[model samples]
Target: MNANHMNDIRKYLKYSILNNCNFVGHERERNQIFDLIQRTIRCGESNSALLIGPRGSGKTTLVNDVLTGFHKNKSFVSDAILVKLHGLIHTDDRLALKSATSQMNLDNAVDGKVFGSFAENLAFLLACLRTGEKHTSKSVVIILEEFDLFCAHHNQTLLYNLFDISQSAQAPICILGITCRLDVIELLEKRVKSRFSHRQFFLFPCEEDSKESPLDHTIKRIECYLSLPENSRLKINGAVRKQWNTILKALLEDKKFRSTIQRLVDVDLNERTLRNILVCFFDQL
Candidate 1:
């Protein structure tokens, strides 16, 4: 390659690493999330959605990515609240309720007279928001990840309460509930089950050989490794580079090889493992 061309490629690689917001695949899911956000905001009404997926399946990341994109868009100005309830340490039900409600500092208080029913608390909070009164603004979209905990430990009181309150809300508020467990819906009360069913969109995992190829993911991971400022080059000889390409080609073409590489590298693998794989692939090539 010419000197200028090589330099340009290097510069593009560096910029890609720095920005790091490029989503290589998952176009369908990404588009679905984006469409949901846009429609909900434009309607200026209350909506709730359940995002279902297994752990490490990019459930939370997908939400964050969409929100990040929304924030970057010049025309999209909306109050998007993302809250995660994982390992919330609460001594009792009161403490748990307090911890849950306190995350937003919603100006509304749970009606003390109603004895803090999930329904009452949500009703009070929505009543206090005066949502549309804030001028021509996109209302709030609250994304709650790891929602199964509430279902597992508490009854469906809170879930149903939120559903009922959302119906009467003056300000447009939507709940984007994300959970890994498939049976999370079963835990909800029958009333909630019906309500959530009406509005929810289910997302399944991306298959290994689907448009989102595992080999491409591996290459992207390798690129990330190469871009790190570790002050230690991979020391890839000409043979090694050729070998790396061969292995990558094979991995892309063969699902078995990709699975083997995944088991070897693991999710929390380091640069050394990556280098070792490149060396081995080179020898094989």
Candidate 2:
């Protein structure tokens, strides 16, 4: 192949990778998140939710989409303060609360106040939430990623305080926890467990049916990607596009390729892995 051909192939690969894949096959999980967001806004009180799923199962993506939708709809949670924090970074309860308060832009207000213990930090966060409520009509949603790891802290202070604040009539704060382990909730203290109960959302791998097998799902995903029209960013001629589709069809027919993809999909059906596999095939071209 000529240098121009190779560059064009690379452009297509880049475009495919950068483009946001349309969310598919998770209607139930999506509805759960939507309901939670709606309840938090309509009730004018805080709510808590826990998202349990395996890695790359689209938990984070689903929550993000809901947040984006909430921001777009002015009549709903448009003015709501959305704060996203990873549990890996702020492992300690006090530190996480401090970071959250900073994200809320309440650092100046709590500046000079010493938070020597978990109680103090929790109090500060509550105070900040109340202040936020007074200033804006929107509620606060705090999303904690890798939630199980954060639960390993002493006394489970972070979870306790977050749930406690959500129970209050004032300072509407919502706590959304994302974790890979289903049994992580079992590790929570009795009080925290009771509070976090009845709000868990589980996302499992998509099940294969007679109409659409796992391999079929993978092919559909690839087709959606390859169907993107060539624009200024990615220029693929008619012949090259045809050749690419032919190559993908050949791969789909290959028994070993189909078996490998099926096995992976059966284990943990996630789009990120499927996209990576497609990118590897494009690299060879």
Candidate 3:
């Protein structure tokens, strides 16, 4: 392969492997979230949900996919205000509450002035949402990333208030908390937990082995990547692409390659590790 071919191969591998593969698991969870958002956006229903998964397991990806589709509908964009809060950025309830005013463009409601106490500010926002005024009555959708960190705050007030609102009939709010912590529920205070709807979606990366051949999805991802369309932007020579794909097929039947893949699957072939493995494959080329 020449320099151009090698570069194209690298780019194609990284893009296809890292970002292109659709979520091969969690079909139910994805659909549930999509429906939850649709109800909140269209019906003004209040809901609270938690998406629990280990880091890099695509909890964020799942939410983004659902939201991106909904964003195309004018009702979704106009009827709801989306506020994203990360535990790392808004370390406390006060910061979160302050940031939310800005996120909802209600800063103008405060006229850029330093607002009242954080609790007061939260109360004010809640009042605005329930005020029955056309502009202020938009539904609120709050997504908390790294949700466990927010639980570490002194009183867990942000979670409490959001949960309280989620159960309300007057103001429609949808709250989704994404976290890696399995015991996240235990971290919540009893009062806060009481208000939560207890709607939890759990996602775990697929275990790729039953002590068998490289699992179907495992090989399928490689097949999809290798069998790029003739007119793909990668511009890889068709004959060379066919040759590489042929090699992949032959390797699937080869004992040594199958054994190697099984060992990798035993240890979990996550996306990050898969990228490194591709780099190692490049070194051989």
List candidate 1 segments past 4 Å from native. 1-23, 73-84, 87-103, 107-117, 131-138, 168-170, 198-209, 224-285
True-structure Cα RMSD, model 1: 8.4
Each candidate: RMSD = 8.4, 4.1, 4.1
Q: Against the hidden reference, what TM-scores do the models get?
A: 0.61, 0.77, 0.77
**lDDT, candidate 3, 1-285, per-residue tens:** 567776787677667655653454567788998888778877878999899988867788778878877788888877788999999999988788779988988776766556555556676776665545653467888899999999999888788878876776557788999999999999999999999999999887763433324355566545655555666677777887777667778876788876787787788876456656775776576
* Cα lDDT of model 2 by residue, 163-190, tens digit: 7767754466778899999898787889
Q: State the lDDT of candidate 1 residue by residue for 138-174, as single tens digits.
A: 4566665577766654555656665664665545667
Per-candidate local distance difference test: 0.58, 0.72, 0.77
User: Which scores higher on lDDT, 1 or 3?
Assistant: 3
Residue pairs in candidate 2 whose N, alpha carbon or C atoms collide under 3 angstroms: none
Error of 3 at 180 (Å): 1.7
The CA-based lDDT of model 2 is what?
Answer: 0.72
Candidate 1 — which pairs collide?
119-161, 243-282
Q: Work out candidate 3's RMSD over C-alphas.
A: 4.1
Which segments of model 2 are wrong by more than 4 Å?
1-9, 12-21, 74-78, 115-120, 129-137, 208-211, 229-269
Question: Higher-lDDT candidate among 1 and 2?
Answer: 2
